[model samples]
Target: MSDRVRLKGRFIKKKVRDKQVKAVAAMREAHLSKNVPRSPPNLKFSFDGRRIVDMQYLSEHLKCIKCKKDIFLRNTVEESRMGLNCILNISCEECSTLTRVHTGKMHGTGENKNRVDVNTKAVLGAVHSGIGETALNKLLVCLNVPPISANLYKRYEREIGPAIEAAAKDSCREAAKEEKQLVIANVDKLCQEM
Candidate 1:
């Protein structure tokens, strides 16, 4: 046998190990490359209008006060319309009794009927829709409906504004906490890689 090696450099024993060493080094490189950092993909946002709840208002009209019979909403504009609020005159079919149902249910007892939540919600919706009392009044006027008095609108804002602000602050705090957790998780992953 003629031991003639051309690929290996001068060594104690002549050998051709070039191809084997190259293959081993390539495999090591391939294994180590799995831990390399990669660029993150860009995120996207999709926005839409606020959602509305499909409330079944017909259930609330059942059982009139005076006669305890089935009732229906009085559809007359004069009777139902009350600015942002309304009156649902649930008329008893049996006794013809007119049972008044406010836009919001009565909150308190005899003397202190302090606030109507429906009115507050209306004002809040108007504010969120990038409008205020004046704009609401204008819209109502254009629709040929009685406008909510400016003073009453202001009163609702005054009562519910603080609650809105508090809710916003809570939401912001929760978002920040979640962001911080995500950042910490990323940092931990990076440290583990190192």
Candidate 2:
């Protein structure tokens, strides 16, 4: 290996050793059953509201969709959408999923709405590509139900679309307003307590 590669590897190994020690100590303090931190890590992101959990904490909590095994996000890919820095991608051991993190409670509604939109798009794309219908058929077959055709899938979308959009919009607005009020109230309370 090149000198640079060797030096980088050594640095990473040392960092990993230090982190492992800290993690072990934290786990011991929290009781051995909990291998992760009880309190969220000190991490700040602009879009993430005050109530948002740190990425480190989230990474600790994330589980693989397939195996349901705990996984860690090793890298983050950032992207700008709606003029915010969203976590566009993350790399984990088993699989990677797209993520969008918003900072502070004030933005929770907006964040939730964004999540809904993303989920809707994902589902729609799956359906359009026949993946969702095929998967549904497989599931139905397991339950001994009749299979469905792609043409009939539009009916499902039509039935669900308006409700989903309305609910998502309402939820987003309500959440954002509520979170903003809560944060302001907390700040006031903190001042009074101090």
Top model number, lDDT: 1
Q: Once superposed on the true structure, which residue ranges of model 2 sit more than 4 Å away at CA? A: 1-131, 189-194
How would you encode candidate 1's per-residue C-alpha lDDT over 91-110 as one tens digit per residue? 45565555665544434335
lDDT of each: 0.61, 0.48
Q: Model 1 Cα displacement at 167 (Å)?
A: 1.6
Question: What's the lDDT for residue 160 in model 1?
Answer: 67
Candidate that scores best on TM-score: 1
TM-score: model 1 vs. ground truth: 0.50
In model 1, the Cα lDDT at residue 56 comes to 45
Put down candidate 2 lDDT per residue, 49-119, tens digits, no spaces.
21212455355445554446554434434423321112333333444433343321112243234332323
Clashes by residue pair, model 2:
47-102, 47-103, 48-102, 48-103, 48-104, 49-102, 49-103, 49-104, 50-104, 50-105
Minimal lDDT window, size 10, model 2: 102-111
